[model samples]
Target: MRSRLALPIALIAAVSVAATACQSSSGKSSSDAAAKDAPKAASSVADYNPQPYDNIKDGGTYTTAGTFDDQGNPFNVNATLTASRVWSWYNADAITYSPTGEVQYNPDYYSDVKVSVEGGHQKVVLTINPKAVFNDGTPIDWTAIEATWKANNGSDKAYSASTTAGYDGITSVEKGVDAKQAVITFKGVDASWSSLFTTFLHPKAATVDNFNQAYVKKAHPEWGAGPYTVGSWDEHSGNITFVRNPKWWGKKGKLDKRVYVNLESAAAVNAFKNGQLDYTSAVDAESLKQIKGLAGTEIRSGGSPFEYSLNFNTKSPILSEKAVRQAIQESVDRPQIAKIQFQGLDYKEPLPGSAVLHSFQKGYQDNVSAVLKYAPDEARKTLDAAGWKPGSDGVRVKDGKKLEVGYTLLGDDALGKATAGALTAMLKQIGVRLVIKKADDADFSKILSERNFDLFLSGNRSMDPFAARYLCDFYCSDHDSNITGSGTPELNKEITATTEIADLDAQNAAVNEVEQKALQEYAFLPLFSGPSTYGVKKGLANVGATIFYSPLPETIGWQK
Candidate 1:
């Protein structure tokens, strides 16, 4: 857990207070309150400083802020902060999955090297200016790549998301024809497998008993690979600094060191405003406005295929019945929730693609108009058909059981809590009782892992249409990981058989058929797809943005 300075209660309270204050500041009559209090229109990514690194002066430090605990060891799978930050300091291929889904950064930015893919397998055959060398002067090669895989899989100490993110996968590793080529094999044909590898390649000297122990812990001089190295890591003071990696093989003379301070957004914002931080992260929309108004600071918003949906705990008495679940979904006012949660900046519905990845399949969006619209009357009828009837208190009852269902959500999850609160209000009119139980991140994950919950809420990181593997994992009973506990035996057989089909069209057809089957069963509710939002420092160059939130430091250079 990366330690974060707690935002004073007064500071946290100020956000809601500021929103309320906007009403009075707008100077509109009470009758026009809704219109006057609306959030400001969001700006496009193109409108900001297009070249974030253009004016960046070399040898200076860059700092960003966000919410995380100090215990977040970048070397451990315990928290994303450690692993994510280490990417800028150390080099590796294991756990270094790029969001571009394949090798090479997204076209939105530039990287000299490109990954060539054939036979549905991606290969790093092409080298980009062999100038790419490790911090200890070891040349980056097929050996380095192989060592990374071996250290993570072959060795005893391996750090990965399954261990860190509370799930496991990466089943096998295989080397390609030469040192310059390699292929990672997965136990199953999961689309995410290719994009989740971020293990770093350590110098041969750092290897310990066949394991890369130096990079496995938070020890430094572990061979700085990016533009910076650990200048200071004062855990007691809650500060970490990275000085320029003189050995950084990039187009040098562009930057010196980058400092990473472990602080929450509030302090980070203040530091950036006071000029202590060159780059900062904006935690919410309000902070974005603050960063934009500060001179020489730029904001960028490109995130994962950010999504959220209500997870119906099928174990609940009321929700166990299909009709009751349908009724709850029908009563949700999606547009209203979108307006409040997304502040009207994002589209209110899922885009034309599978819920797993962020790409459109022609005509997919055209078929979703009816599945998501609000239909209270239909909801009531569905509940009625499911044997639930209104009682004296106007609450629904089935077989002498009241149609009251409890929901568990993350307490610190602002968006989820807001959405659940909205659902609570909406369901009240339909005679359904909803109880919200607050759980910390650990408790929530425990429930999910145990398949325990009346209803759950969460988000997806990608959005590719026909992401058949995702549907199978979430809706197939045979996949023990599916949380809903509602998959049928027949569905599992169909999912497995479809995997063997070789033809692309035939595979897609099979996937769509599976999706329809899952939808009919209400395995999961589809939610809106929205662009990720980020706040960046102005003049930082070559920081290519992708659908996944990983940074491209190799392509980034300071201009000033």
Candidate 2:
């Protein structure tokens, strides 16, 4: 039998709640001194050893820094990155993909998963564990499966999902031979089937209204099924606490409590210096510098599956012409931008070539070098050939219109601001005026949702190793997340072809073809591919920086 642990789902909305209320009070001052005096340790970003359960010590509290406000609702389409991080602990998935792209199943939740294809249709059978149940005593069976499918399958307009790539292909979900088994049938062969079910909602809360509005400021811990329960939430301080669940049926988790504190990029580093944050990502140059000399801290760096890119709003008048978009793509110097962003850091990323596959992933091919080359001379020539002529002020003019574009700075992060400044200077050399429009983090989503920018710096993190999952989500014409508006019938057909191939090699080849075509059209400009860096408190094992692997909460504790 697989070990089971209970996890929390909601925040108890009280601003005055003390962090000590959830765990034994060590008193903040003494704990801070001890944290500063602890022995230092280090790990690499490529390392994926989750410490053996036997080596982990029991009964301790861990605190970490997060970027965004909690959404509470993981199923919501607009859920923040921090919410996703928190969900990894509180929610259970049938299967999960590792940082190195290994797929493993959670035996505590499902006994087995079988995949088969017949008559051009793919089917998946999931066998839920008999003893598994939500905190409210609801069986983790067909109702949950059906609700998950209905909410994410894209058949209904009411249900809002982050991405409908895999779920949209599902035709039906029916009960299998037993009450604990679920039989899912797809409309056609989908090689990305494993990507679905990373998150699920209860049947009662799967409705449109409940999924969106019900969890706005509330956390319904009753819907959670992990090893911890919602202890307290101090909204004013942006601290959330999770305590051990007495009803957990599996091996007792090592940590007595877990706390996630919301802090901005720079503030998070200061918190770590003050012995408040146990783990925090060192994303910018300044954060990396501040943590270098910190005692009892370890800096882990590696190549990340995430990449930043300049997304073009093809519908905008300034970027409507294909030649103009191609020119803008060729003008920007990705290497220089990478150098500036990661100046003092140990890791530096190479110019990214593919939008679908990162350089570290298998089957990655350099498709952008031929089309999106960084050559300002070539960019000027392309613009001149496309009826855009240099004006007296050195800005391009085409048929009484100026070749000016607006670049939206989503967050006031140092890396983004530096990139924008560099890009503004580079574009001017090619007779294109780039305007930097600053947008608050809170308003960034609204701007993207309304498609109100000509160009923006954005990125996508692969949920799975398979590149097919990203094809439709990022490039499909009708996808809600397709802000570029650059999809075509041929591109759509090529993307669909990748999903139909079951073999990994064949699917990768098909994806490369799609990427080449997309890059030729200048769909989106790929920047650098690098890993997320973090400063972790030494002795805290399996709780720091990671790429693909979501650390199991039960396995995270002080090293014995």
Candidate 3:
């Protein structure tokens, strides 16, 4: 499950939130003192214009720019964030999020959600709203929940699951008082039990082939139940149009149609300028300038729950050695990249220290600095010690192999392209060859599932406030979402055990300790935090960045 994670309307890496005391391997915050000296954009939450439901007009068409990838299926283990975002629009959400990151059951899908401790096991009773029905008229019931659990609980390896963390903890998902209620029982106590069952898969999709292979290039809108359903999808242009579901039982959607077009950063901005798109990314200097003096559009800026990181494919030959990965991270100057990234935007932040928590968030600490730092000279020495010798071409060579790494970049954003170019030069200084591959927005899911690059630069955007949930996502080798391939059986056991802790703080601390060990493997390097900037038409409401809150389509439309 994505747990509702994705980059919408042109990807932009942003910030995080949590109350954590994650320490470095040395058991201390290595950069807390340095953090005290800098200004931070995360001091404020996202400023997406919020208006009451009554304030939105009854009907309109809201078209926005977004990436479209052939992600196989929304529930496929190899599914990309793009696929998840598109799937979300046409599916019923079991839960809804407030702008401040609070989770509440969506009454449209559930009549009641009861959590309790029965026989020392955390149990959840979800009462499905009887009025809820899929587009195909399949009644929403325990069968669907059971099917989702069976496919994602890692019980059958043939069925590819994104992560078996929350699902693995469940002992059984049986019918409750009736078919409308699902009685979910966990093996042990889990404080974050509410995080699971956020979305359900169709009971008919329980087969391995259907879960993993059969749905590529298919939205399968018939299996979905929500306010909107896919009206049309253009395979050539990678564009999709959604219309109100004729069989929807909930309140009517505010807009008559929602259109998502695959547009690169430059093209998205141009489209927005020409009134073709309702939303466009402007987080970087160059993109922001394109809309500087636009009369009808405004830039919305504030904290976001997206975080940027470079995931090292440790299974690859060159990066198989932890030392090489560490050296590469040390050679890259993050501050230089940040300065270039936020140059003209004036978005200030202390050097980011944690991939899961931003500086302005509660319990935020510097976990990255103690493990790695920008020291090109030291990095060179480390590479030399690791048996990578400088060849006549100036690139490092070991065992007749050059220390070359492939980096996959998506879209044609000027700032993203420039950043990749800067990274190429930075790695060259350390005698490592950085080969760049620029791909279109539509190829993102393909590149990720194929592992086509040694280094994948992307953001882990969150839909919930629980950062501890990602421990398994990033540290369990069997978890398909752990793209780094650095997880071990030992780490997986530790993370799974940590999730069972009854206290939130104890669970967080235990997860942090295990995280410290996993990160030392050097397969993941933390980079930028936030200041999510988006150019939006003035009257659009309940859309754009709202920190971690994702509003339903029924609540987003043109302001009256």
Best by lDDT: 3
lDDT tens per residue, model 3, 473-495: 77678677777788788878887
**Could you report the Cα RMSD, in angstroms, for every candidate shown?**
8.3, 10.3, 4.1
Residue 116 lDDT (model 1): 43
The regions of model 2 sitting more than 4 angstroms off are 1-45, 67-72
**How many backbone clashes can be found in candidate 2?**
12
lDDT of 2 by residue, 410-448 (tens): 655665677788999999999999988877776644666
What root-mean-square deviation over C-alphas does model 2 reach?
10.3
Write the candidate numbers in order of decreasing TM-score.
Answer: 3, 2, 1
In model 3, the clashing pairs are 14-306
Q: Which has the better TM-score: candidate 1, or candidate 2?
A: 2
**Total clashing residue pairs per candidate?**
43, 12, 1
lDDT of 1: 0.48
Q: After superposition, how far is residue 288 of candidate 2 from its true place, in Å?
A: 1.8
- What does the lDDT read for residue 148 in candidate 3? 90
Prediction 2 TM-score vs. true: 0.89
